[model samples]
Target: MLDGSDLKSVRKNAGISQTDMANKLNCDRRTIINYEQGVCEPKSSQLFRWLDVC
Candidate 1:
């Protein structure tokens, strides 16, 4: 599973905002916030999409 902090770090390093990531991943901005905040986890497909975005 992808670690939330690592996910946040990757997103930050990629210079994309949560909204940008959400748009790329076809998810809600709050989902990105939840993932980054460790409030929830993303599915494997979402992880792949995130990898593609980054």
Candidate 2:
């Protein structure tokens, strides 16, 4: 599973807000925020999309 640093780095490099990334990936901002905070991990499909984005 990706760690919080990976999530934060990818999102920052992608130049998008949590909300924008969530919209593109069809999830909630809280989900993305949780990911970046290491509060929770993404689901399989969400992980795939995150891979695509990063």
Candidate 3:
């Protein structure tokens, strides 16, 4: 599973913002914030999409 810090790193390295990531994942910006803050984890499908995006 991707940790919050790892997700943040990947997102930063990919040169995307939380809004952009949320758009790519078809989710809310708050969802991206939650994931990056370690408040929640992504579902399998979401994870797949996130991996594809990053």
Candidate 4:
């Protein structure tokens, strides 16, 4: 599973902004920020959705 930092890196490398990621994940941009900051972990389903994006 991808860690917070790893997710951030993948998003960056994919040229996806936090807002865009949030849109795709059906969450707020702050949620994406929180994920990157290690404030909380994404749910398994959410993580899977993100992986689908990758």
Candidate 5:
């Protein structure tokens, strides 16, 4: 699982919207929201893509 702070920072650095990242990761916007809010963790494949996009 990724650290929530890191996730938020990366998203900001990449200038990516939650919805945009969700679209790129083939997930729902709620997924990104959850990750950012630290409500849930992303899966391995999603993590890889988040890193790639970030």
Candidate 6:
């Protein structure tokens, strides 16, 4: 299972920014921030979409 740090690492490694991730995920920057901050988890569909795009 991907956790907040793991997601952060992947995004940094891939050179993807939070705003860019939000655009790809069809959400807002705050949502991506929430994910990385562990305030919430993405929906399964959102997770898959994030993986697909990033």
Candidate 2's error at 21, in angstroms? 0.5
Identify the runs in model 2 with alpha carbons over 4 angstroms from their true place. none
Q: Give the candidate number with the greatest TM-score.
A: 1
Per-residue lDDT of candidate 3, residues 1-54 (tens digit): 669888889889989999999999988999999998899999889888887898
Worst 10 residues of 1 by lDDT: 1-10
* Selected candidate, larger lDDT, 2 vs 4: 4
Score residue 11 of candidate 4 by CA lDDT. 86
Residue-level lDDT tens digits of model 2 in 2-54: 79888788878978888889898988888888988999888778888887876
Which candidate has the top score in lDDT? 1
What pairs collide in candidate 2?
none
Best of the two (2, 5) by lDDT: 5
lDDT of each residue in 1-54, candidate 1, tens digit only = 657999999989999999999999988999999999889999989988898889
TM-score of each: 0.91, 0.82, 0.89, 0.90, 0.88, 0.88
Candidate 2 has its poorest 10 consecutive residues by lDDT at 1-10
lDDT of 6 at 17: 97
**Per-prediction tally of clashes:** 0, 0, 0, 0, 0, 0
lDDT of every predicted structure (CA atoms): 0.91, 0.85, 0.89, 0.90, 0.88, 0.86
Q: List the residue pairs that clash in candidate 3.
A: none
lDDT of 5: 0.88
lDDT of 6 by residue, 1-54 (tens): 558877777888889999999988889999999998888999999988877776
Q: Candidate 4 has what TM-score?
A: 0.90
lDDT of 4: 0.90
What is residue 53's positional error in candidate 2, in angstroms?
Answer: 2.4
